[model samples]
Target chain A: MRVEVRLFGGLEKFVKDVRFGEGFPVDLPEGGRVAELLDRLGIPPSQVFSVLINGRHASLADVLREGDRVALFPPLGGG
Target chain B: MGKIVRVDMTARKVTVEEVPEKYRLLGGRALTSQVVHDEVPPTCHPLGPHNKLVIAPGLLSGTPAPSSGRLSVGGKSPLTGGIKEANAGGISSQKLANLGIRAVVVEGRPQDGGWYLLRLSPEGAELLPADDLAGKGTYEVTKICRERFGDKVGVITIGPAGEMMLSAAGVTNNDPEGNSSRYAGRGGLGAVMGSKRLKAIVVDSPSLFNAPLKEPERFKAAAKRFADILHQHPVTGQGLPAYGTNVLMNIINEAGTLPTRNFRFGRFDKAAEVSGEKLAEVAVARGGLATHACHPGCVMRCSNVYPLPDGRVCAPIEYETAWAFGPNLEIGDLDVIGELNYLCNDLGLDTIETGVTLGVLMEAGVIPFGDGEAAIRLLKEVYQGTPMGRIVGSGAAAAGRIFGVTRVPVVKGQGLPAYDPRACKGNGVTYATSPMGADHTAGYAVTANILKVGGYVDPLKPEGQVELSRNLQIATAFIDSTGLCLFVAFAVLDNPEGLPTILEMINAQYGTSLTVEDAMEMGKRVLKAEREFNLWAGFTRADDRLPEFFTYEPLPPHNTVFDVPGEELDRVFDF
Candidate 1:
């Protein structure tokens, strides 16, 4: 299965050559969770604060489907 | 002791009076709101002689408190027809505090229709004829004032939009860099200032952090501790300083609550194109600052200096302003957002209100969606005082009425800001109940709903929203009074010692033994006074509601409607 991943708020620093909001396809086993994706990106789970899957809040254990849009962020806040 | 300067515009007289016993403990919004409530008649016309414009600094504004340079401008709102207190970040608050000035109250209309400028210095206060500065943009006015007075003087001014008494016109002051972009921009306070024939206020003070403190050593210790608390926070110390407030664009977009196309949708596909990361890239390439402070002593430095392609500079494109002009109008370009932001800063209009008004105009087919050029041309019409421009300056609610647009996103009479209420229900409760009318800062539930700052409240659900908004609104009211930047809440909410440290600083400065409960009580008092003023001004429980469209229209991504009960909204102020 393939999932689309994007990083934001300097979380892009964790992944070389990937800019903010730029999506890249990642190959993972069927029913891969967010924790596995973080490990695949070489980003520690502690570094990423919030995770969104298909625009909904997801946890580390949430299963990812093929063609899912996943966005990872460092703790960021403004109004 | 501090003094209050009263400028009687009708008589063209300026008088300085000692701060009253009742108002000695109050500053910023607390002082301004109290002055407005005590002096201005509730039933009077907002733009008439009966309304008074009160400008005040926070309690710790002139102290060494970090990010404590907020200014509060209060008046009966021409836009909302209710009590309004609009806050801004600029050097004037600290200057005013250093000059021993508590509040500057502009009262009565000018019978002769002549323009004037109020000059405040350590020497005295005086009102000078400002006919030469009349009809100029805020940027030009600030520049001219800086040149005439020393460059360090803080000039707070309005533009032709205010001269025309447009409801969206906002009062603006300059940052330390002489960029007149910091605004008390909401509820049409500038129109109230304009009606008084006051074009600008030039504050000249030699000191910044020399406000008399009762216990200088204790205040210094508390201030140091507060700064460390801010530095230890990830959001304040790291993310904000790196990309500025515009950093929230991507996170909000990802959360599926970024109000797009004038709240017709939940998210904009091109959000990242105009986001903080992109802004930082473009600004640095153009020799502009990616991170700057709105005022001195601000450790967060969440402001940016964005240089446009036209060689003009918009000091900081804040998150709400960017969200307003970018996703709300369906314009994906940063330069366009920068241009609109610059125009608003120059013309003395609230960017949020102007963007939301332009969105309503687009909805009315006056301009097409995503047409940046047309939006620019229409916005420029305000300088010429065109009929269409007047409609634009009249704010979102008036524009909606003029064009018969039923889907206007407004609560009370003010336009809704960046977040879609349906998706961010806690903020929705805030928008519905805040006396200031659709002001997000009144109760920023986004901390909990989206950012997980204080704690997590389900953004998509209505549960635990009212309590979140209520507590935040109370805390925010108190923070606004302190004249500290509301951004401090990012750290203060997370840190256990935040509130206590703030109270200690206040106690050290004022010699008051206030507890945490007393701070909470102050917040409630401010809100109660504002609510009572609104009630006397004819606002009922029905006025505290999101528009009908929010209730019926289901936003995308989550397919959620604003489900917070109306009765619950009324309960927001039950304390």
Candidate 2:
């Protein structure tokens, strides 16, 4: 299965060529969890604060389906 | 002894009086609100002679405390028709504090309508004829004041928008770089200043950290601990320094609470194009700073220098302003956003109110959506004092009424900010019930609702929202009084020692053994005073509501409407 992943708030530092919020497709097992996607991107789960699957909050154990849009962020805030 | 300088604009006389004993513990919003409630008649027209403008520095403003240089400007809001305390970051707060001034109260308008400037220094406070400075933009007014009164002096001034008594006009003060973009940019306090025929105030003080401290050594130690706490937080130490407040663009967009295109959608397709990442990239590429401080002793430095392509600079384009001009208008270009931000700063207008007004105009078919050039042209009309410009400056609610657009996103006549309350229910409760009327900083529930800073609360759920907003609003009222930047809450919320460390600094400075409970009580007192003032001004439970559309309009992605019950909103100030 293939899923689109985006990084933000300096989480993009884990991937060499990806800019913040730039999405890239990644191949994953049929029922891969968010933790598995983070492992594939070489980003430590500790560095990621919030994960959103298709614009809703998701956890590391949540299963991802094909064509899912995943966004990962570091601990960030502003008003 | 701290002094309160009262300037009678009607008589053109200035009198310096001792601070009242009751107001000794109060500072910033606490002091400003108390002064406004006591002096200004509740039912008087906000722009009339009865309204008095109170300017104050926070309790720790001129002390060695880090990021404690906030200034509070208070008045009866011309827009909201309620008591207001608009806060800003600039050098004037520290200057005023160091000069031993607790607050400056401007009362009674000049019958002759002659312009004047209040010059303050250690020698004395005096009103000077400012006819030469009339009709100038804030940037020019600040520059001229800086040149006349040493470059080190801090200048607080307004532009033609204020002079024209626009409801959206805001009071602005200069940063260290002399950029007059540090605005108390809400509730239309600038119009109150303009109505008094006061053009500017130049605070001339040589000392920056000479405010009397009761326990100097203990205060210094506590201040150090607070600074370290800020530096240790990733949000303040790293993310903010790298990209400023605009960093929230992507996360908020991904969270589906960005409020795109006048709240028609929850997310903007090109949000990243104007995100903090893009802002940093373009700012650095154009010989501008990606990180800067708005005032001295600011360790977080979550401000930037964005130099536009037109050779002008908008010193710090904050998250709310960017969202207002960019995603709110469906305009993705950062340069266009920068231009609009600069125009607001120069015109002394509230950027959020102007953007929301422009959105209402677009909905009325006065201008096309996503037309950045047209938006810029329309904003420039405020300088010309045209009818269209007056309508624009009257804010979103007025524009909506004039154009017959019922989808206006406002509470208490002030416009809603970047976050859509439909998705962020905790903030929704705040927008509805806060005395300040739709002000995000009044009680930023985004900490729990979206950012997961203090604790995690489901953003889309109505459960636990009222309690979340209530607690935050109380804590925020206290913090706003300390002259500390609200961003400090990011660190304070996560760390157990944060609130105590802050109290320790305050206790050491004031020689008062105030506990966490006393601080909480103080916060409650501030809110109660504000709420009581609002009630006296004829605002009832009906006025404490989000616009009707927010209840029915389900925002996209999460597909959530603001479902927080009105009865629960009434509970926000039950304390």
Candidate 3:
């Protein structure tokens, strides 16, 4: 049930001064879509370019589990 | 013609040499590697007096060529103990070229205890005592250098980290706005400069000298067509201009190869947090530069700026740094990452290496994973010379040792960039085989259909990865040596005539009729020469490998280890 939320790149402003997303490894309230987690992080769905959970691409409805390292990256534009 | 500027630190002497006869065929990486191999002793200690640091502009530098302002800094890497070349974009290359200087060589060691700056103008070269600028960060040094040398002179300087000779130290270069934001940020080249006891190098823009152009009309015609190809390409023109390389964050994550949590996973769970769309949106809202060029005349303009809280300027955070610092270590704060980007600029370090190493430390629980504040403190507030900061700054291999973590992914002494080889097989070949260590740019072959290689293939394909990596690496070497931007490869490869156009431009500039195939051959030779230097430096096949962890611990999502056969990976020289 626990999901530790981490954000990166240009997305840190949403979490106040917390540069690294450390909302604690905790249990999720229930099953929800990726959109719901975005809401939790104050991110709009429109702003999300890519979403993956535990090294796999995730849909909003991808179920969360305990101790999942939920990592997020800002949009990538690499040379 | 541009000449080589040589400075004898030991004797306080300076001289300029004409471009050598054999080197007439080379530029960029090719020129740098060839020069280093022939001039420097293979067994020379990278940090000792025998190791000379040479900075060379690409073949196309000093011309009105698109994305051709890149300069290569080459020497034996203090970190890798091999021939190393870290390239960057700034005003230095073109300015140096304009001044009729082909390359600048800093040799021997300075006996003077005080730090000094090298000033090169159309008049000549001189070493100035810069005791006042010692220990200053790059930004402050640039401001002072600009005031003293006038704003037109290009500058390359180090930060406090470089002064301390940290292994991660990067050489900072001034951006178009005169900020010391862009860097040749890899392989600890700054430490080489630091070893010479030099603080900075100031270049006065030269107005008169032009490298002889063989056939000006043909070059112009070809350049126009090449620029057109770039404009027409989707990835190069549209995606890059709109989102920059950060756009790959989402796409690569979608493919499950973003390399999160210190190589523990191939993808991040919350990738959307820093996806390019999100970055683009925030950049729009916060007055951040949406997309810009790192160098002038760069039509691709993949580089962009990220603003501070009040929309004030901060260094534009690149995707490699973002992924390494963002998801790999489990941190998702963009501003913190941006601040770290700025700090790395000031500290004169590579963001990707720093981030990757920090991820290793985080995995070891040196500090809690995803704690951006802790990461910040460890880098900026805490002395990097301290045990903890040194562990992080020494790069991933060293940090992995300190943390007792075995999942370190590095080749040679350099840390891998953001791509996860478990998912992207061709890039895996690149990571494994590149002479430049674990560098993504060594051979960045995206989907064949994506216009980079002028065809499309499934990203998951295992069939053509070897050839793909081989061809791409050859092409990249050619591009890098020409001092041309690699992003231009996207556009050139897409159109059938793109490569020819590039060749046409080069031949036209040099007044030679060298064919495109010959250029490709030059590319191969550059890699071979660099590899030969590495071999001479006492590296072996065992050094050309991913760590044991990548081979054993199957990464998540795909549950795939680096599946590239060791034999096939080793045969990357099969061209």
| Alpha-carbon lDDT, every model | 0.94, 0.93, 0.77
lDDT for each residue of candidate 1 in B181-271, tens digit (9 for 90 to 100):
9999999999999999999999999999999999999999999999999999989988789898898999889888999988988889899
Docking class of 2: medium
Q: Comparing candidate 2 with candidate 3, which one achieves the higher DockQ? A: 2
For model 2 chain A, give the 10-residue run with minimal summed lDDT.
Answer: A70-79
True contacts kept of each: 0.77, 0.77, 0.31
Isolated chain B TM-score per model: 0.99, 0.99, 0.96
Interface RMS for model 1: 1.1
Residues B1-575, model 3: lDDT tens digits? 56888988888788888888888777778877888998899899878899888888888887877778888888888777888888898878877877777788899997867788999887888998899998788888999999998986788998877777777887778877787877887888888898888889998875412545777777777777877787876666666787787777755665677888888776676666776656667777887777877767888787767886755566577788889888887877778778787888888888888988888788788788888898889897424467666666678878877668877778887898877776777777787788888888888865451222455443445567788889989989899888887777766766778888888888889877878889889988988999899898998888777777776777667777776678777788887
Best by DockQ: 1
Between the candidate structures 1 and 2, which one is better when assessed by lDDT? Answer: 1
RMSD of 2: 0.9
Say which candidate scores most in lDDT.
1
Give the runs in model 3 whose Cα sits over 4 Å from its true position: A1-77, B206-212, B310-312, B381-384, B447-453, B456-461
DockQ each: 0.78, 0.77, 0.16
Relative to the real complex, the DockQ score for model 1 comes to 0.78
Candidate 3 vs. true structure, TM-score: 0.87
> After TM-score superposition, what is the CA distance of residue A46 in candidate 1 from its true location, in Å?
3.1
